[model samples]
Target: MPFLTDPVLTAGAFAAVPQPEIPTGDGLLLRPWQASDAPAVYAAFQDPLMHRWQLRAADSAHEVRGWIEEWRGEWATARSVQWAVVDAGEGALLGRVALHHIDLVDGVGEIGYWTVPAARGEGVAARGTSALARWALDEAGFGRLELTHALGNGASCRVAAKCGFALEGTKRSAVLYTDGRQDVHLHARVRGD
Candidate 1:
């Protein structure tokens, strides 16, 4: 794919793609994070499921506030794009989906995302991820995209599969999780050859 940055291809009026609000099948909407989201994020972490799947340790509201700020910084600098998820009907904060590690030169990037326990299995991750992947390839002009997860995370594997990522095998000692150096499954989706 030729490397060209078209302002119109982006979702909104920004030099780069303006983060758009994406709605999951189950009525979860993903938009940009705001300072007010800190409270919900802090609360979500208290769920053991969120802690286990999302690799989260204990965090305070202050830290979550700063975390939301950092994600916005990426858009400010044209570095990465993120989407903050909310329950569509209730409008309650849920989780986040992001396409970070962007390399415009090589037309490549990586995807990372996580949702609170209450938000999982509603097809939120798959829909959010597929939307981001299609946008990354068609709008962001990336040639290849990658996603990674620890060996035991079945849910993540399912999400990746739903988004058309091909499993590329395990990387031994690839990631050092809380359990020490752990192997990880690598998945990739490449644009038309």
Candidate 2:
């Protein structure tokens, strides 16, 4: 059961330490999602745009709490991690940033984020995503990270560019949306870039 190469990251790389809070330098901080934040999470999902891009909608504070629990569990498994992007002073939830589809053996993960209706156009997504990317590629030892979004999602494209994730290519009919299948833009960033 041995491979020719060693894992790029140790299995317990993330689990070995407490999840650190990341500051975006834009009055926002990315912190662990809390059960008490369920109400805010639920409110954000009520936005039509937010619900459209997300894989699932939080119908109630209870569902959001469940999601927070699941997200916390992933940290232990080293499979994925999610953070609540909040106002640094007020601690109000403004958005979310996450690294999913993680592969410790390859040192890669996918980044995803969404901003609340009130936070849109405020650079919340860009700032939060940039902070997470730095942590993932520089601090966390990930060799590569990817950000993908539906072709029509121009805002997301801008966020990727702002965060230094170069557009790799377009994935034809890559994902299904509420509207139907759509082409997706694939962007990526690697260590030292």
Most TM-score-accurate candidate: 2
* Candidate 1 Cα outliers beyond 4 Å, as residue runs: 1-17, 23-26, 55-58
Q: How accurate locally is residue 67 in candidate 1, as Cα lDDT from 0 to 100? A: 82
In order, the Cα lDDT scores of the candidates are 0.77, 0.92
Highest lDDT: give the candidate number: 2
Per-residue lDDT of 1-193 in model 1, one digit per residue for the tens? 9658643233322344566676655576778999988888888788877756566665699988888888877775545778887878988876778877766557767899888677777777787788777767776677898999888899999999988999998989987766677788999998862
User: What is candidate 2's lDDT per residue for 42-112, written digit by digit as tens?
Assistant: 99898889767876877789988998999877887888899999999999889999999999999999999
Which RMSD does model 1 reach against the true structure? Answer: 4.2
TM-score of each: 0.83, 0.96
Clashing pairs in 2: none
TM-score, model 1 to reference: 0.83
